[model samples]
Target: MATPSSPFSFLDDLFNRIGERLQPPAWAVHEIQHRAVLFLNHVLQQEPEAQQRLLRQQGRVVRFQWRFVTMEMVATPAGLLDLAPAGSVPELTLTVTDESPFELARATLRGGKPSVQIIGDVQLAAEVNWLVDHVRWDVEDDLARLVGDVPAHTIANGARRVVDALRQFVGGRKPPQAGGPSTGSASTAE
Candidate 1:
């Protein structure tokens, strides 16, 4: 049987072309970077261990690069993150190796990390890696503050189901249920 071609195949090329030709205004980029820092800090506040780890690396700037976007941030003495001053040298740099938005989205949906090239201070890189491995935003908890616990739990559960469905679609394999054999792949007889 022939596989069907995607109608949206051209979207990847179209997005790449647009990305190459168009850059976000400096003000917009700056605002976005600030917002990202704020969000990261909020998540960090929920994890005292993460905050303590960040404090250990205080004043070390880390530059993150993905395609044309770059953000430099430094861990504060108070164990929070702040946007580093323009032209401040980074002690460590992490560049995302994936160039395709579609691929990145698929990987994220499948709960996988994007490929990244690390450079500079090994200790700083290790600290950053530890943070990545442990810290996570508790979206459900945040939602519960606004709407109460039961609704938040229901909403989070529904969202998880939707995300799992999307992950299955993107991965081309259904995750095996507890103690069940996976019939996720194409038939062996085929």
Candidate 2:
């Protein structure tokens, strides 16, 4: 028996088709990569220990791959990140194994790391992992610099609450069943 498809399933199929067909322009991709490197360096600057660790691995390139996007960054002498030169071999490569953006977002909201395929230098990978475990961007501080401390605090608090609510929603929600509508258990729903 063929189960009737839900509206969401139709939308999902449409989006999947669109995503597979559309590719960002090379210039846009390059710009986004440059901006990402700058943001990473900004975060690294906030953590002196992370900088010191990265400085030890200066000149080593690390390539990150997720779906169709690839970004290669090198550790600089100043312990900041910069875009690796074209064709530069990476000392370490980390590929996110998750193919679905929704699944990745759900895992992240649940405070879990996405599955990754790691290759190359073990020490470099360890250092990268340490940085991931230790470093975080201080968005509130940046907002405070732009506005004021009190407003920043209020904004941060509001954002935190919103994130918490999203986490709860994502945690409780069931993934749609293949070939059918989602049939959540009553006990789970409540």
Candidate 3:
């Protein structure tokens, strides 16, 4: 007798094929990375300290990888970033440890940091961490320029509330302290 295919197995196979077909071309990937670099540089330009940090790392190549996508960027003396030349060795590499895009997006929307592994230069990693902790995109300001200030503020507030709700729904509870008593109901009397 032939083995039967499960519905979930069939669905998974279909989705995999669809994803393969929808993947962007190399040039599109390059364009997207270029835009991302531009956006990062714009945000960095707003902070003099961030620019100074980048300036200290000028000529250093940092490679960032998340899943199958990778982008290598070089810090310029002008304290901006540019795409590192192909075949250049990176001085530092940062890899996002989370494999699930949904989980990563949820954490980001919840204002939680995504876990990452750093390899190579320690000073560079520290600088990058400081930048991550301090720098934030001014989405509301950008939106206000496009739309009216009132609408932009309203939209931003709504988005924040939605993200808060999602975070709560995603089990945002903190874990019990190390070596401390359990916080679960089972640990409580009655």
Candidate 4:
């Protein structure tokens, strides 16, 4: 991790420190799942500067907007951890490049996240799509404002806490009743 000397690199250093200090915990998967959904929700609320949303069936909405973005950690070819953020797309129909997307993810998960490119890999992309296809995002807030909220911070902290818990878990230390994502009890309403 780079030193937190510049404003640009401060968050990177913070994440690196967090990753080391917060090893995977028993609740890692659940927290990631929760955060992934929230991130997608946050993204959905962001519209293209000119708006790229549709009013659909039963007054529902469908948007391919690229407003809300978040990060994902993946294993690398060198066996390291890195983080990737989601990219922007004002339109719903994307080119879906196999290598560019997956390679970006692999790089980030491997701890070589590019300073210039902050986007997630397929695993993270799939998670985002799951939320977009199945859940609804709040369309009122921008990404910065949404992420700045108390509730959003709480959710992020929940994710980070659970991930920290998982490192110990994979090592055979289990926390009682950390629970799974299928119990249908989510920290936020979708």
Query: Relative to the unseen true structure, what is the C-alpha lDDT of residue 44 in candidate 4, on a scale of 0 to 100?
Result: 44
Can you give the TM-score per candidate against the true fold? Answer: 0.87, 0.83, 0.77, 0.21
Worst 10 residues of 2 by lDDT: 4-13
Q: Is candidate 3 or candidate 4 better by TM-score?
A: 3
lDDT of 4 at 73: 33
What lDDT does candidate 2 reach at residue 72?
96
Q: Which one wins by TM-score: 1 or 4?
A: 1
lDDT of 4 by residue, 15-119 (tens): 556655765664674477457645643454453311122211112212221112223333223222223333422222223232233344444444343323224
TM-score (C-alpha) between model 1 and the true structure: 0.87
Q: What is the lDDT of residue 55 in candidate 1?
A: 92
Pairwise lDDT winner, candidates 1 and 2: 1
Against the reference, the lDDT scores of all candidates come to: 0.91, 0.89, 0.85, 0.40
Best by TM-score: 1
| Pick by lDDT: 2 or 3, better one | 2
Q: Write the per-residue lDDT of candidate 2 for residues 106-139, one digit (tens) a residue.
A: 8899888999999999999999999988999999
Question: Lowest lDDT 10-mer window, candidate 3?
Answer: 3-12
Give RMSD to native, each candidate.
4.8, 8.2, 6.4, 20.5
- Candidate 2 backbone collisions, by pair: none
Query: Between which residue pairs do clashes occur in model 1?
Result: none
Candidate 1: tens digits of C-alpha lDDT, residues 1-190: 6543455457867888898899889999999999999999999999999999999898999999998889999999999999998889999999999877877898899899999999999999999999998999999999999999999999999999899999998889967678687557756773
